[model samples]
Target: MLSNFDIPLLLGLAVLATLGMVTMYSAGFDHGSRFVDHGRNMLLAALILFTVAQLPPQRLVQLAVPLYTVGVVLLVATALFGITKKGSTRWLNVGIVIQPSEILKIAMPLMLAWWFQKREGQLRPLDFGVAGALLLIPVGLVMKQPDLGTSLLILSGGLYVIFFAGLSWRIILPVVTLGAAGIGLIVIMGDRLCEPDVDWRVLHDYQKHRVCTLLDPTKDPLGKGFHIIQGMIAIGSGGLSGKGFMQGTQTHLEFIPERTTDFIFAAYSEEFGLAGVLTLIATFTFVLMRGLMIAAEAPSVFSRLLAGSLTLSFFTYAMVNMGMVSGILPVVGIPLPFISYGGTAMVTLGLALGMLMSIARSRRIMQT
Candidate 1:
């Protein structure tokens, strides 16, 4: 099976996995035991990637519904008895503290794709409405857990499935217009959007703080604004060539919070400079383009939607992390793909890559 796979795509994924391990090592070196844990996670991710790549795309499609159903149940369980940390209930313990929402990041696309496949060539506006509801179920739950970043990522992945399923622009255009107007209204209203004496019914306090911080980081410079301000400083201070690897003052001195996780990009930029940043971005672009090509050639609608959504989700992860680090967006705890140090996220990404490989290989088989 390995011999029959798409060699270029497999090789690209291998290269990325290698890069992830190296970056994790550097990022976790000071945090004693973290480096070892990251190494273990990388190895596990590699194994899962290989295993999933060997599976047929049709088999994956068959498993979609069950996978999604189990994932949604786990998310509901998390909401009920989850471990609360940092004012968010996003993790559940079934011997291990696991984030169930990560599972939905992949599962949502799988289920939507499967649904689309069932209704292929007969899609309607009402079908799309149902799909949107399917997506919102998990998204709403995660948001109530107050894991804004993860919720947005899951929502983005689900939206990708809708887009790839030939969802009409007639329906999409009005939604986009409303979204734009809503954002405009928020900006116009500013702090009043979440006044304490007001209704206080819409957003959680932390979520509201994130938006307020995005609007004006200086407003709470020493408090909630610190992450954004420090992240931007680290990014901008890199200039053209970086301060050199392991020589990042902000990172070394511990000024950058979550240095090995959400804000890893700031540390990376401060160390490797503009050239390194471009190289990383180029690799990500290559992966996404290749994944999309695979989706285009997939043998089934399910494979196509899953592959496309996974690709876009990968892109969103990179973009959101970089945007947050550069101070252009709110400080959401989103890891830079393959570059940040975390076991669960690495495994999730590996699974996504594996599904892409499966889609590509299935297409190759069909061509023969």
Candidate 2:
């Protein structure tokens, strides 16, 4: 079991997990037992990672269909009868409250990789279409729940699998171009489009507000824009070296909201400064490169696709969380992988890492 573990990857994870605990200690010291809870969550995630790494890639493939099916069913159930909090119905009471969308973060990649692996030799455009449909069903369901962050993660994970499974640049380039154009248009018409009376039919009113707030947070400094405004301030306040550990005035003074959760990046940035942020990014990059290497060496199609997608999912999580905190993107409530304090997100991340480790172990066993 010890030999099955990937040393370099484990080392990278250990570094990040350690940083998370240290940051949480400072960020949540005032919040009773929050630091303690964060440590407990990390241990749980470690346990999950260890348990999952023992499974073989083939065993994981066997789990894909049933997991995806159950995920979609729970999503549907959440939409129909889930608990509503702060105007979003994203959790269901299945013995205990759970957010079903979290399952798709891992299951989406698993199911897509399994689909492509089944049609390995004689692939067709129709196979991609079927895969897209499978991907969209749960994404659409989660979007209806209005949990944009989780849906985006799920969407990106599935798309990464599709892209790795021979998706042509011909189809990808045009979509990328269109998205870029849309962003440019939004910037050009920011003021007009952000007017209260103008209906952005696709987005909920609050979601629309979040986009407008991202465009210019000062527009409502103490209202809907508070999160972005404060986040940027904390990050900017952390200069070359930082204010020193446990000395973040912005974080301790309560300027940075959600210091232990969604906005932890801002709190982390405030205390650690630009230097610390770079170190954190370098560690994440190391893990990412390591994961991609594992994927490149994977012995099977299912393993390769799964490993690649899950690896990129970490990229998405870090980039999105950091981007939102730094004022470059709309605040979508994504946590910074091991750094942010959240049980569900932590567990989800552990499962992803475990799958990657499992694939890596498989390759080494084959070589032996």
Candidate 3:
């Protein structure tokens, strides 16, 4: 089974996972179980990846619609009968607690790729309109769960598929401009708009607070801003060469929150510094580039769209996590790909890698 796998991509994943274990060990000094749990999740995901890679793209396409439908139905059920924990109705307990929004991350690209493949040659406004409807249904449900990070990922994943299927820049440019304008407006009105008395109509209270905290972490240094401040401090203190492995003071002192999960990048920086950061970035770049080449050479349109979208989805997840930790973006529930210590995310990433493997393997067979 390993013989059929894409060696370069697997090697890149291996390096990232090794980096994750080292950082998790240093960051989880107090909680020994976290290190073990992280390792278990990685191994579990590896097994899943191995099994999934055995299937070809056609079988995956056959599973797409049903999987997407089930995922959305579960999301709706969750809306009606989901368990609320810490004020977020994100988990469903069907004998075991699971987050349904995570399903959308993979399902979005699958469903969209299938939709476009079916309508391959005769795409029109109606087709794009139908695609948008398909995308928004689950994304809207996830946002209703108030899980903004997952919602964003699903939206981006679906959008990537749509874009690959030739969504015109005539429509894309205006949306991009509007997004830029919206960011500018937020920056300009940061002080007044973030006032305690003001109400953000669209965003949840905590979500609004996160944006405000991003703009001015010093305003609530001891409260809402602590995570960003500490993350940046850990990053800055790393300087160039780092403080040495397992000796990150910020991580040891507990200033960096969720050190084995969302903020693991900071802990990594404090120990490995700038050189390690560049190396990690290069490894991810290799994975992304390899994925793009595989997508380009895929034998079918569905395979191409699915593979390309999954690659960009990984990029988006990693970029958002890094940006938030670097204090350039608001804190979201996103975790660094392959480096974050969560079972579900590791599995999702594994499924993605398996899809890439299946796509790349198809190309190799065609050439041979």
Q: lDDT winner among the candidates?
A: 2
**Candidate 3 wrong stretches, greater than 4 Å:** none
The sequence of per-residue lDDT tens digits that candidate 3 reaches over residues 1-368 is 46667888888889988988888888886866999999999999888888888888999999899989999999999999999988889999999998888888888999999999999899998999999999999999999988999999999999999999999999999999999999999999999999989999899999999999999999999999999999999999998999999889999988898998999999999888999899889988888898898889889999999999999999898889999999999999999987888989999998988888888877776777
Please report the candidate that would top TM-score against the real structure: 2
How would you order the candidates by lDDT, starting with the best? 2, 3, 1
CA lDDT, every prediction? 0.84, 0.94, 0.91
The TM-score between candidate 3 and the true structure equals: 0.98
Q: What TM-score, to 2 decimals, does candidate 1 have? A: 0.94
- TM-score ranking, best first: 2, 3, 1
Better of 1 and 3 by TM-score: 3
* Ranking 1 against 2 by TM-score, winner: 2
Q: If scored against the real structure, what TM-score would every candidate get?
A: 0.94, 0.99, 0.98
Model 3, CA-based lDDT: 0.91
Q: What is the lDDT of residue 54 in candidate 1?
A: 84
Q: Report clash pairs, candidate 1.
A: none
What lDDT does candidate 1 reach at residue 36? 77
